[model samples]
Target: MHTIASWRRLLAEFLGTALLVTAVVGSGIMASRLSPNDVGLQLLENSVATAFALSALILTFGPISGAHFNPVVSAADWFLGRRTGTGLPGRDLAGYAAAQTTGAIAGSVLANLMFDLAPVTFASKERSAGNLWLGEIVATAGLLLLIFALGRSGRAAVAPAAVGAYIGAAYWFTSSTSFANPAVTIGRAFTDTFAGIAPASVPGFVIAQLAGLLIGVGLLLAFYPDAGRSADDIVVAHPIDQAAHRP
Candidate 1:
């Protein structure tokens, strides 16, 4: 029921997400190794690497897969597309989610292997406090609001940089370190490192993120009701295509 184009998009999502997670997990390991005595310095190094890597990955793959790499973002796209008919089809949305999750897991495994660690160990870092859940909700909501707001204001072309910057800022601002993406959260659970989340904690984090997604949708509907008026200019479309069409 899917076309070749859809498959290509899914593949891009897979690769992008995998790379994103690789950057996250790999940087966390490297930071821990490099800054063994200073938690603050380790965080700084990890955040910077992740931000830069994220921007690069988004720019590289946005044309092919919309650079979603996040289940919440894909779900939001599906929800908007349902109303405007310019979004991805339900089947394709599902494919995107599956690919993102698979890629995230693969990325974690690869990162662990690259570091000579066990490939399938569960994370032991407990992060399920109420404050952390609130932070996740806040982080996810802000991310979605920023993304869809750009789509509404016709500035989505800067999403790669803007989103990466927001995440980097959130790393310091949010209490839970802003695991706003569910796929990334799951992937982090596979690694028992500085960035890892315990398996028992992932459900709470994911639920908070979904709740945040709903809040983001509500905000988008209230403020940018016409963002999806043009399907091609919506949240995850190719930036190059957006540039070519400008008058």
Candidate 2:
């Protein structure tokens, strides 16, 4: 288990989230420009870049903060932790969420600057639709399921590849292109690029994601009732105490 300081954990979350969003928005912009006439190509490029970046980031920071770059993931961790007294406390959960939100915004601004776009433009691309909302629900539920299931089972060592692979696959399968993360959804809104979601569309997407989270949790508890019984019970090990176990 990690015994790192609180400040360091928060820093890891912030930096990791920022970099993830940066890759998301930056790649979207580049893909759009490079394949202006091919929407499929644009999505292909963006999804590939995001998958690779996310895998690398998770592996790099998982030992420090569990690499929870999304609010839903943090919240889920806190919820599950409460069950066995091994997850984050309320205060830490709030901190992680706040840091993720802030980092996401900063990452969007950074992506804009990198692409020579306005640093604070609000996205105008509206992505509201019943089908898309359903996609969000499916996307987020699958994500949480994968995460907690990996923890419940004894396969956390494969999380980086597994999670990244799932996200990559979800990108192609979901109608909303799987903006399964609330923070990333918000961050993408800061840029009016191909990957951007209009600010107006943010609330609905977030709600759907949350709803999905709840369903995922319910499913996890039902299927893996003994999962996450304690920090030690987790096979993969959350970053909460990964450092403590390090040699």
Candidate 3:
């Protein structure tokens, strides 16, 4: 594969993550408006929009950055591929995380402004509960498991649709609606709309996501001991070279 420039990959990550959060927060706000009295209907609308948008974004940006809009996904790619020298390096991981996080916040603010709301109103939806935390753990772990497993099995081509479907299903199956990405969790804290999480709830959610990351690593290793061999392919394969992978 031809090597892509580091700047291009970083730009892809930034833009991809921003658009994803935009779809999520914007759809949530629209759903609430369209179904003011029907919470179930609103959730359905939100989840469907999120699922479709996620798949499309992955397809759009996967070639440039592997479409890893989530911090945990990027971190897992680094950790799993560290020993094999095939996954993202520490520096690029940091860059990806920073870009993804900032993009998420920007996306949240954009969503708010598009809806005639404040640019950075701190969210007020408190989601600090034991069950919700557990849900995050489950959701995050399952997501990583699916992503790495597909790469390991040479089935990465379906990752975009599969990941989207998993997240959409998780919205109903998990108590916390599957805020599996740390960057996204932080961004959602910036808005008080239907898709937002309380700023106070951010720490707990982040902790749970980290815990989920560890569990996901464990599960991936257990199921596919050599999964690290495909680390560079996590989420999806791109054309990043070792030089671009470096910090």
Candidate 4:
């Protein structure tokens, strides 16, 4: 059994994802304000802030919840570890996803409030395009690959920095700006800001991300057949609380 309570883990996921989104949306707002005309500079600032915040959040919460702020990451962990019983259990999947999504939306609202905008303004930025979908697939696939590979190789210690670096780089390289997370996409739709996405564009991005999850699984299996052995350590290693299972 696990060494941490389920509620604690869920809370960590919620707060971590919320804070991460706050960093994303908040930084985007600040970047836009700081460099009103330079889209390039704005992106750079936003990406850098996100990357740093993600890494720090991981470090802060990794030991408690594994710091999986993304639904895809949690799903990947469950899928890859199902057979071995080392990763997230089936029962907790829905809870994790729900918590992450809700927290994400809350974070976006908080960012809007911080910036003196309406609390729940829906985004109007349309991001529909074949290339953007392709970018989501590629970005999500690469992320899963990197995360699982680290677990398999026992390099999870550097996951914070490495994952951050990968995402920072992907923000520049990917066409979709590396929105490889469904919950984050949903949250971004809550605000019409520099980091927001149109609600209409959300479904497509989510579908692409899910597809990327599948592709990532296939790649992980092919390259690291024994990845399941380290499934419990994906992103970071955390002990599961066994008290609930004990008599």
- The best candidate in terms of lDDT: 4
Sort by TM-score, top down from the best = 4, 3, 2, 1
Clash count of each predicted structure: 0, 6, 1, 7
- By summed lDDT, the worst window of 10 consecutive residues in model 2 runs over 230-239
On the 0 to 100 scale, the lDDT of residue 9 in model 3 is 85
After TM-score superposition, the amount by which residue 157's alpha carbon in candidate 3 deviates from its true location, in angstroms, is 0.3
Tens digits of per-residue lDDT for model 3, 67-112: 9999999999988887888777787989999999999999999999
* Candidate number of the best TM-score: 4
**How big is the RMSD of model 4?**
1.7
Q: Candidates' lDDT values, in order?
A: 0.86, 0.85, 0.92, 0.94
Runs of candidate 1 exceeding 4 Å displacement: 1-4, 234-236, 239-247
How many angstroms is residue 140 displaced in model 3 relative to the true structure, after the best TM-score fit? 0.4
lDDT of 2 by residue, 134-213 (tens): 99999999998898888777678888888888888999999989989898898889999988999999999999999999
| TM-scores, one per candidate | 0.93, 0.93, 0.95, 0.97
Ranking by lDDT: 4, 3, 1, 2
- The TM-score obtained by model 2 is 0.93
